[model samples]
Target chain A: MFLWIIQRDLLLAMRRRADVLTTLFFFIIVVSLFPLGVGPEMNMLRTMAPGVVWVAALLASMLSLGRMFSSDHADGTLEQMLLSPQSLSLLVLGKALAHWLVTGVPLVLMAPVLGIQYDLSTDALLVLTASLLLGTPVLSLIGAIGAALTLGLRGGGVLVSLLVLPLYIPVLIFGAGAVEASAAGLGAGAHMSLLGAFLLASLVLAPWTAAVSLRISME
Target chain B: MAINWFKYSSPASFYSLAGKMIPFFSVAAAVLFVVGLYIGFFVAPTDFQQGEAYRIIFIHVPAAWLSMFLYVIMAMWSGIGLAFNTRLSSMVATAIAPTGAMFTFLALWTGALWGKPMWGTWWVWDARLTSELILLFLYIGFMSLQAAIDDPRRADKAGAMIALVGVVNVPIIYFSVKWWNTLHQGASVSLTQSPKMASTMLTGMLIMSLACWMYAIAVILIRTRAIILERERHTVWVGQLQEATQ
Candidate 1:
């Protein structure tokens, strides 16, 4: 049942390819704008590379988060899901998983392009991809809680960012730190482990919280 | 004796109860502040290392302590609201947030003012400072989420969730100094150990911290009363209470 829900969300997301493409485009444009705004010096871009990418990823994930539960709730699908025999927690998790697949995975895959644009080293590129791979899923999971809480609200986009950004701080610190550590040829393992622990913790915690939020918002 | 758990849990009951308690707390807070300031500023011995500049700790440490202490209280109220579905619990949580945020700003502001002399820079990405900055953001996020939702019940629930999720960050911030070899100093007044400072300095800091706590209670009680009235405007008690006030 959970797999079916995941498949359904994936198919729905694929059908709205424009939404996916627009989000990705926004990610790229926002990232590109950072270097332009900060100046095009390779040395400066390299120093700022980890932060710029992480910030872009954070913003992009937030842009996609409002759609996570909002569209489903809007179309009455969320109500049907809640009323279904399948547990709401599992259903919400499935939706969040699909969201990570669509939004976060693409960002991870596209990191090399972003890395090259920012003149990141080979080591930095590897670390950036690794951090994003571990980090962005946590963003999707945690953001789901915010998205669910603001499911039916106007100005949810602004509220969602406000609510979620603080939660994103540890991820931002660790993700960027991991890449910077690797770029400096230091061991990035501790940073990566912390990110993994964070992801694991958020995965365990966010789904139930999201389910409760959905119930609250729907009520 | 069974605790009157539900007695003060109702918004109407808490509203009236809070009103009765505010004056006492306000007076206590004012008295403590005057005494603590006198001791902290004039009576406490000068630090051999930091000299008069170290006097800022009287405000900085207390503000930082209250900021974290209030967040825990806020999250506890939020947790109660989420777990037990109490309207007053969430209202209390909402009432505590702005003050928590304000103290966080005060802590950071005073820390910056203190740091300029000690650390020789206004800001550094030092672990403690960074985590405190994140703490400020967390408070703002909680406030913004609550304000954005039009429905009070929904907003309370949403804010509770954010508060709960953000609570996990609090411990991380507290321990970040220890967990990583960061620039922030380890705790000087931990419960596990005798305080590292002189007795007079400790006395002054403790008095100031208590003053801050009393002030927080007074402010939150006052704010919660306002929140209860605003939220329960349609309730009979609110109308009667408004009439009484007028």
Candidate 2:
């Protein structure tokens, strides 16, 4: 059931490539704008890079949350899914993973290139990428709950951010902290472990919450 | 004889019960506020380090405690409402949000007032302050989420789910002072250990906190009564109550 949902969503996303590209471009543009805004000072940009990149990733992930269930909901597929005997949580988990695959993976892939623009050392750049690799999935997972709750509500896009962003703080702190720690010659292990922990915890928890939220919203 | 606890779970019965209790709590809160402030402003000795500015702890500590305390209570009511589909519990949860948010804003404001005098700045990115700010955001989010949904039942359940999810942060906020050695000071009063402050200061702060509790209960009960009428307006009991009032 999980793989089927992922495959189905991937195919749908592939058919409308612009939707996926838009989120990636948003991540890139937001990251690129920082250096321009802050001036081209290497020392400052290097320090600012981790936080800037992580925050952009957070926003970009949030922007795509609206797409998680709205289309299916509008077309009445969501009602069908809810009626299905299979657990709704599994279906939501698959959608969250696909969301990460489409939106989160690109940012993880792009962070290193952006890090270079900030003059981040090679080791810091690697840490930035590795941190995003673990961290962005958690964003998608937690965001799914927000998206599900605000499903079909007016002003849902803004509402989702208000509901979800505070919850995202620990992820933002540790995600950016990993890169900063690595830059300072401190091992990124502790921060990385915390991010991994967040990813694992959200993986277990968010889908179920989102599933319950879907039922509430749909009813 | 066993008490029928579920009797007041009905909105109609709870409405009158809440009305009867409000005056007692309101008077207690008023009296406690006077006593707590009297001791807080006059009787408590001036801190050697902070001088007279430290007296804001009387309000700050209570507001901060209630902000976190009410969130837990709100979530507990919300959780009960969700699991058992109880209407009164959900209404109580709704009523608690504004007061909780007020207390949160009070804590932040008083912390700022206290901070300006003691720390030489109005705010810092200390763990406790940041977490408290997040707590305010969580309260706002809960209220807004419920406001956006048109169906009251859907609003209740959805808000309840988010409330339960956000409950994890309360513990983090409570422990943030210990977890990171931030600029914010540790607890002056704790359950396990004796308080770290002078006895009079402790007494005044406790009384102030009790005042806050009474104030919160009085306010929440009144709000919940209003909510009951608004939500149950179509019912026969509400219609009869309106006629009786007229």
Candidate 3:
């Protein structure tokens, strides 16, 4: 049942290619704007690269969070999903997993291109990709709770960022730290492992909370 | 006889109870602050190394301590609201927000003041400072989330979930100094250790901390009363309470 739900979400998302492309485009544009704003000195860009990329990714992921559950809730599909024999927890987890695939994986894949603008080294690019792979799932999982909480509300966009950004601190710290470490020729394995532990913990915790929030908002 | 636990859980009863306790706590807090400040500022001996500049520790350490302490208390009240459907629990959580934010601001402000003298700079990207800044953002986020929503009940539930999630970040903030190779120093006073400083200094710091604790409780009680009244405005008790106050 979980697999079917995941597949269904992916198919639905694929049908809306413009939405996915637009989000990715926004991510790229925001990242590119940072170097232009901060000046194009290679050394300066290298120094600030990890933070700029991580923040842009955070904002882009947050922009995508509001759409995660809103359309379904609005169309009554979420109600039908809730009433289905499949546990709401699994449904929530499945949707979160699918959202991570669509939103997070693209960010991971696009890191190399963005890294080039920051003048990040090949090694730094690899570490940046690895950190994003581990970190963005955490973002999606945590973002799921925010989305569920604000599912039907007006100005949910602003409220979702306010609620979720604090929770993103650990991910931001470790993710940016990993890239910076690799850039400095230090081993980033420990930082990457911490990011993985954080991701695993959030994966286990966020869906249950998201399910509860969904039920409350639905009520 | 069975205690009618649910009776005081009512917003009206809790409002009156909070109102009654506020004056007592305020007086206690005032007394403690006067005595503590006398000991801390006037009588406490100067630091052997950092000199008189260490006087900021009296406020800095206590404010930092309370910032973390209040986040935990907020989470506890939020959990109670979620688990048992208690009427006053969310109000209690709501009441703690401003006080918690104030403590966080105090921590940062005094930290900067202390850092300027000690580190020779007003700011550094130390792990502890960064995490505390995040803590401030978390408190602001909770308050903003509650305010943005129109329906009080839905707002409470949403704020509760955010609070619960944000609680995970508090321990990270507390331990960031220990976890990373950072510029910030570790705790001078910890739960499992003997005092690292002189007995007099430790006494002064602890007393100031106690004063901060009492002040936090008093402020939260006063704020909780306001929350209960605002939330229960349509209720007869609120009308009567307003009439009495007027």
Best by lDDT: 2
Clashing pairs in 1: none
RMSD of each: 1.7, 1.0, 1.8
lDDT (10s digit) by residue, model 3, range B148-245: 87888888888898889888778887888888879999989987998899887788888889989989999998888777777778877677775546
Q: List DockQ, one per candidate, in order.
A: 0.80, 0.93, 0.71
Point out where model 1 deviates above 4 Å.
B1-4, B242-245
Poorest 10 consecutive residues by lDDT, candidate 1 chain A = A150-159
Q: lDDT per residue, candidate 3, A1-219, as tens digits?
A: 899988998999999988888888889999999877878899999989888889988988999998889889879999998889878888899999898888888988998888988888888888888899899999999999999988877888998998888888779988999988877778898899999998888778889999999987887
Per-residue lDDT for B140 in model 1?
94
Clashes of 3: 0
TM-score on alpha carbons, each prediction: 0.96, 0.99, 0.95
Q: Itemize residue pairs with steric clashes in candidate 3.
A: none
| Residue B192 lDDT in candidate 2 | 100
User: How many clashing residue pairs are found in candidate 1?
Assistant: 0
Q: In model 2, how large is the Cα lDDT of residue A104? A: 97
